[model samples]
Target: MTMSSVEDSTQAPFVAPEIVTVGELLRRDLHIPDYQRPYKWTVRNVAQLIDDVDTFRTYGQYRLGTLILHRDARGNLNIVDGQQRFTTFCLIALYLAKHTSADVPDTSAAALPDVGLEISKANVQDNYTYVSESFGSRRGDLSHWAEFFLDSCEVVVLTVNHIDEAFQMFDSQNTRGRALYPTDLLKAFHIREMSLEHASPQLRLAMVRLWEEIPPESIHQLFSDYLYKIKRWANGQDVPQQGFSSEHVELFKGIKEADPSNEKNRWARPFLYAKNYTDDYTQENSTLIRYGALSGVEYPFQIDHPVLNGETFFLMVRHYYDLGLRCGLFQDDAGAIFDVLPELKPVLDLLDAHRRMPTHQLVRNLFDCLVLYYVDRFGEQSLDRAALMMARYAMAPRVQSKQVRRAMVNNYALGRSSARPPSTNLFQELRLATRPQEILRRVLASPELNGYPELHCLFTTEEGARR
Candidate 1:
């Protein structure tokens, strides 16, 4: 693959397996880069981690997993692998250091014993409670456990110099642990790209702040399900069965370095140097969404947006993320469509009232196709009719889907399925539906839908806020 080919050209140094205590390792600056996902250890995950450490301590010395790091332009150790354990250990160390508090937030990661970074409140409370119980809540026992955790607990450290090789190692190692989310990899790559582009310290930190501000769930859905899906359809291609993944990230990444040695794609090099002038920067607003909607920071921009550098790339990410959330919420601003939005609320409500009904996915997928078609063709002016068409089209597939072709919901309100639903292949149909009129006509005329009942009940249900 690309990783293998890159490895062949650029040999990354892999250090020998040397064991170091948590205290010894934390003595250096170890940072979980802003791109990494937040510490989201469940109470169970935290309990299991501590239990493993406590169990290992009984054996004299416990060997923790390997940690992966890449030296950045500034020469800080940007952690790539072992984030889960590393962050957990740091939090545990802080708790032992009596640094837990709600009002005071820790954002420094310099010295190990003094390293103080804020973990999520829920995780801290849950984990500290678990640790208290795990060590029997005695001062002597706690002190001994802390010492063992800091001095005896050891891990193998792998420091990679090359960014590409580091990512390769990160991905490979992730398979043996908790996999880094695709977005995590994307963030690491873009940060390196920004450094390569020689972006200013202010600009680089700005992008980092922007990335960290975005809600994780929103970005995940935005990339994998929304923007990626829409982009493929716009290009008249079938959506990949795997949805968006690392490969798609490469496509988004494009060519990082121009082939000056071989001579091709010359414009790419100059484009990377293009800077965003503040006077020309403007507030971003889209039919799908507005910039800074989530973070409250208006992102700077460039005229015509000539280059795909880190800043612009994240700008693209944020733009599509906003659009995706709006589409999912059925909050499109198609002028006259506001009149239709209130009328369409019931359909969204019914699906949600049942926790998105017989098939949670069926409802959302149906909405995706419908919203995509509406946004692409008739605009929000057609939302009311679009909702109706979606409701009817959903029933059309019921005729054939054995999974959803049931009456259990009918015991109260009949619908989709327990697992996969009737809305499977529904996007292609909605894509073809184009205009609201076309959607209404095409769905009503489907041969498979022979004699489905009227969708009057779908409209009659009491309204609810959009999902």
Candidate 2:
């Protein structure tokens, strides 16, 4: 397919951006595309938006961000961006027009008088209750609240004809530093990928629920602790230097979304050449999206992605998110798991020491990787062995030389350039190999050095690790 951009000189000019108050913008039906994430603005976000509009009373018209829209064949305004702001405004208007609370403070709780619109969701009804609490502080006459909101607040309405054009424009906005998180984009990417086939909507919605259940702060930690590093190391790649930074959002590329039954999943070619990704990057200092595409699926760019395809990627993240929460990395104290499992305390201690290091540190990454790997493979009962194996590998005399040390890891099952995980037997061998140093040598000694992170027929340096 031809790669099309909104800025293509041959393309028609976009519909001019219009300065419109909420009144005019609300005059038409608007839709959030299915690929978008649910409205995740917490009460704090809601409070900020409302506080900004409160400025309109002192100042004439408050300029919120742009409202980007694309006209679908059915004439509904498909919000390409700014869904959060647009949805909030609708909720606010509806909140004002509908309910009147006596004891509760929602002066705007009454109802939208004659806007001829309705917005609904199963869970957001409670958030609307929070909206009432927030707006109740304004406590003016309930009657005029919708009118003031519609008339006082304004947004620049940017409408374009093609959805792709709208996305390209939306893409430009996110290339800015402060826009969306990589996880947020991954949420959208998987939602869109799932929609590509006959996947269950109920199942998809369930996944969204699980994702939303994760607190925003924990999402990054889940990636840093397990998903990002484990997946990268599995694919024989290093996690980005930014180490889960927002700029590295190109973590998952969408290559081909054909029916899984009919297709072997292939990674999408990413837009790695995008200027934002390569700004300070140069040849000697850089690792890229294992960068290129095969002949069958043609696309615009390269991305270094995990070997796990879409649904598998999503499921694994969900699994590890739960794991991190259980490991005390997310929910309770970072060391709380050790309290519950006195046995795993030493394992936790070793991993905890590396928790503050950069994720790119091979020792730190592999330690975290093996803990999650062992616990995930053999269950919590195996934590002590997992800890011992990691420490043994770290302090092994073979590791004393920078060469064989890195090489042993490079030669391990994880170091292979494949998305597949290490087999059960390999883990068992690791479990058995973590003995007293002399016995460990006896157990693992051989020219072939079968099945341990032992440095025998392997490449040993960082360059070898990359190889």
Candidate 3:
């Protein structure tokens, strides 16, 4: 198909454009068409693209064709629509550039720091850009296949003006297969500029305190899902709405109190508890717990974010620590489990001997312990027993296969999970006592019991879990 101009009304004929590798674009010119939505790919996509390319020699569908870029003198290229693919290619290129280079300084070119990508200003592209723009970077793992693709794939670019025209051409020229979502496009816009810093450490750190506890491995899905939902909401689409109803203003309010200086008791206040209230940070405060729970799904950036206020996001941090506790890495003395199961006392002494062991070491230990506990308590059907196990754990089922738990745990212990906490109130004490029976009792006994709110309201009522 031909490249059209937003500036002109002419629908031109298709013309083959000059082919270029991502390296050339980095060295010279690239601009996203006004019509080109935004970069949306996450690290997962980046990793996957690399893997796909890596399989090219064997897997027939691996090699992606030349990407068309409409460049402008301002160094801005009207992506006209291959933005996601283009962005992904650039990230892969960066990965290849970094991993293959012997010089450590050159490796900085592939630097994919953990931060949000905001593509708003000129000269926005920078070192971190490639990583945030591509799914490969978001996914955080570059397989051998991806490495191969990063090392080899080249992009073909076409230049023109009229952002809409380019975008329309991009939309129509799809001979490949599936069409990407507009949400994906919007995401690409930011993804493309991943190298630039989007938020300050304050904001980023606040975000971390809010949702940092989410497993690093699942961050991509959480981010993608939230961003997609928000975009759909913005477009008046019928995307499923979870609960946050508050507009952006209210959400920010929650974060404002999240600061350490603000005194209003907040979900994040607990996090400061961790820092030992150092003189500089002790003044911080966050209202996440009070407002977050009250706001429900109407939460700002209601998506599964990494942090909120200054506290570790509830679900993620709680889950991670819970997992650790389950594995005997943490323990409770008086039946009260501290968040991380403090490494002190009798438990610490016992674990000290095995501290150097791998993640699988802990996971298997936990698994064996849990199984034995269950078997002793209620035999093999313990999972089905009336004992509210899910509530006790404050997490969902092991939906994410634990096959890699060993490796994942090792990464976590090594501080490599890029882990963070969950949003404020996401795992408040409410989650800790989530057993259906407990909920039923709470509902029947207390006005505020609400008993799991919507999802299990029926379970607490005459209706059961199915209801």
Across 1-467, the per-residue lDDT of candidate 1 in tens digits comes to: 00111222344465455678777776666766644545667668878878888798878888877898776545567777777677677667766666332121132352221112244555656776876565555666676777777777798888876666677777666534436567666776776676656566556666765776666655766566555554454444555555677656665565354325424656554554332232133323342234434333343322122326466777766655554444444233341212234545656554444433554444345455446445544546657666755665454444334355223222111222332233334444445553556555542333243232333344233420120
lDDT of 2: 0.52
Model 2 C-alpha lDDT per residue in residues 1-467, reported as the tens digit of each score: 01111233444546888988786676666666544455655567787877777666666667787988876545556677887777677677667656543222232332221111122353256567789887687666554555556776678988876555666577666667758766765665565455444456565655665666665556767765556655555455545545665555565543333534323322222322232233334332334423432222212121123323345445556666666555545445443433324545654564554455432245544555555555554456645544555544433323333333343444453433221222122333433443334222322212223333533322233422222
Q: Best candidate, TM-score-wise?
A: 1
The ten-residue window of minimal lDDT in model 3 covers 390-399
Q: Give the TM-scores of the predictions, in the order they appear.
A: 0.65, 0.56, 0.29
**Candidate 3 lDDT, 1-467, residue by residue in tens:** 11222233352433457655444445554444332323546555655665566467465333366555554324354445565676555544555555444111122342221332243111125423545454344344444434434334456666544434343455445523535433233222222222122334344333333333333323333223332333333233333323222121122122333244646655555444443443233233334435553322212222222234323233333443344343233333443433432322333333334334453244333232332223222323423322233221211111122243533433332223432321112112122433434323422111222222322331243422322
Counting clashing residue pairs in each candidate, in order, gives 3, 12, 81
lDDT of each: 0.54, 0.52, 0.36
Model 3 / residue 1 / CA error / Å: 24
Positional deviation of residue 39's Cα in model 1 after best superposition, in angstroms: 4.3
> lDDT score of model 3?
0.36
TM-score-wise, the better of 1 and 3 is: 1
Using TM-score, rank the candidates from best to worst: 1, 2, 3
